[model samples]
Target: MVNGDPSRLAGQCAVVTGGSRGIGLAVARRLLADGAAVSLWARDQAVLEAASGQLAAGARVSCHCVDVSNPDEVSGAADQTRSRFGRVDILVNNAGILGPRAAVGDYPHEAFETVLAVNLTGTFNCCSAIVPEMVRNGYGRVVNVASVVGKDGNPFVSGYAASKAGQIALTKSLAKEVARSGVLVNAVTPSASETEIFGRLDDDRRQKLLANVPMGRFVEPGEIANLVAWLCSPECSFSTGAVFDISGGRASF
Candidate 1:
């Protein structure tokens, strides 16, 4: 577990989609460190088991094999999570895919649909299944891991940009809906993090992406985790329907 004030998230439980690695895994580690019971949901059982082993948090953690793109699967996993942890106080919608890096006209139709299915619809399914519980509990925190492309509109990644844009819009709409219910919903846009997602990029594309960052380095998963942890905490009480940028000086506004 990471070093932090363990009592910050004491008695809380969180559900993190795509929690097997990268930003999702890092966020899980932070939440576990902050004393929250975490339920990790991912599509791969083998990867989930490995992540669970890495965490090694014992009873405070549980792994669920779930495809966020499937509403039925999401609902079932939500039920299991509630059964295991009693309640879910936080929901992190981090399950997403960087679709083909082709121009809009050249992008494959199937790939575009798949990206939207996993990134946009998946987020919707999770929120629909879990947010009601948060509403009933009178407390919740939802963080959507969006991307800079959503706001800035990067070229040759139309599908990814569109999906993340949908997430940001969804976050705002949901946050407004539950604003009076003590449940806060927000989005974080991180520019080009050095995750497995990078495997999709060629050297030229990678360099072009890096050149846009004034910081001259990729954003780290741990860095995004820190921001997400705060957003998931009681300390982030005033913000909702907001977008937090972890873009390493890449965001202009």
Candidate 2:
């Protein structure tokens, strides 16, 4: 349900990675409710199908199952989105993995690599493949999902934190690269949310994490989606290459 007008995004098309569930699904739902044709990209076809049904906007929503870490698959998906929708004006890079919690010296080597491959390199893959079209059109919005840990650094999840920090850096660099092209690139660093990602933390760690937040509550996906929807809209013009924190006052400086 759109809070204000349903035509806010009328005629636009958006691609949201990790759109099958969690914050990605919430953002897709908001974009569609605001009247943008949306393509949901994720690795699980079945989950994507379910998400489409949940959106209930019929042909206005499409689903493409692809791994964000794979450039070939991302290329094919971007091409297909253009073929089906004619353009992609907004892109939300929200796919990420939570690697096993451990000290930097003891973290699983493969797990760290996988996190970077999916969270950092994957964001680069999506932007590289899709932003060229935005450049050609002279209009676009890109919102990369980052994390507060990227800034302050959490104790146990070094890979996740490092990947998000890289994402923030990427947003700055890309925003500059495309600044003159009217393609605004920005990142959102959200605190722990009531999503699957938080489930990765054990009770003790989760409690400690919450203790760091002044709000003492997890963020809701819908709240993050609301911010993303605004960032995706033309109203967000004039802001680029910056980070918006939805961390419940946990971010300072």
Candidate 3:
């Protein structure tokens, strides 16, 4: 569905956090298809290898076992990616976790912290580690994969919603900071998508989420990947510190 010039990103290199599966994997495939060398970063080595095999782009794909929440690991991974590809021109902060589904009163404090650590702080870590180089080079594209629940808060997932909202805020703050540096920072807020994350939900909760999407269906990973490919492309100029909604009409603003 994402038909375009394959060479649009021929000379670029991209890093996708959580690139082993789900949205991150889809984004990696799309970027590779667009001719950008891709480095997949995830915590699971086995899954990362499987994803690398799926891409099947020898010499243009690398896998880094990284915990995005750990600054040292992120720094090391960034160095490895740069070593493999010479430079990183695009970053897709797609790593996140859906904390337990529970009311705020029942939510575990530790779980809340973990969610923020991964979804919000992890995004910060990657940007801090990689964006400075992009700044020096005067060219970059950063896309934070936030969620629609971030804008319109969802019940029973306070931690996840809060983390996503924080990511959106971070996207805007950083985008403005690099607005004139030829680097564009933006976020895509997708509604509930058809991904492994949904396996964590129960029948009733799943139905409730699906019903909230007026489209009456879950968004496809490829659909989200298509949008992300553009955001990471050279043509996505003039849009920085903005949030693009792919929420199936669920985003009111």
Cα lDDT listed for each candidate: 0.95, 0.94, 0.94
Error of 1 at 202 (Å): 5.2
Give the alpha carbon lDDT tens digit for every residue of 1-253 in model 2: 5463478899999999999999999999899888899999999999999999998989899899999999999999999999999999999999999898899899999999999999999999999999999999999999999999899898889999999999999999999999999999999999989787767667887798798889999898999999999999999999999999999999985
Error of 2 at 164 (Å): 0.2
Residue-level lDDT for 127 in candidate 1 = 97
Position 19, candidate 1: lDDT = 99
Q: Give the worst 10-residue stretch by lDDT in candidate 2.
A: 1-10
TM-score of each candidate structure, all chains considered together: 0.98, 0.97, 0.97
Error of 1 at 127 (Å): 0.5
Measured by TM-score, how close is model 1 to the native structure?
A: 0.98
Give the clash count for each candidate: 0, 0, 0
C-alpha displacement of 178 in model 3, angstroms? Answer: 0.7
Report the lDDT tens digits of candidate 1 across residue range 8-123: 99999999999999999999999999999999999999999999999999999999999999999999999999999899999999999998789889999999999999999999
Question: Which of the two, 1 or 3, has more lDDT?
Answer: 1
Candidate 1 global CA lDDT score = 0.95
The lDDT leader among the candidates is 1
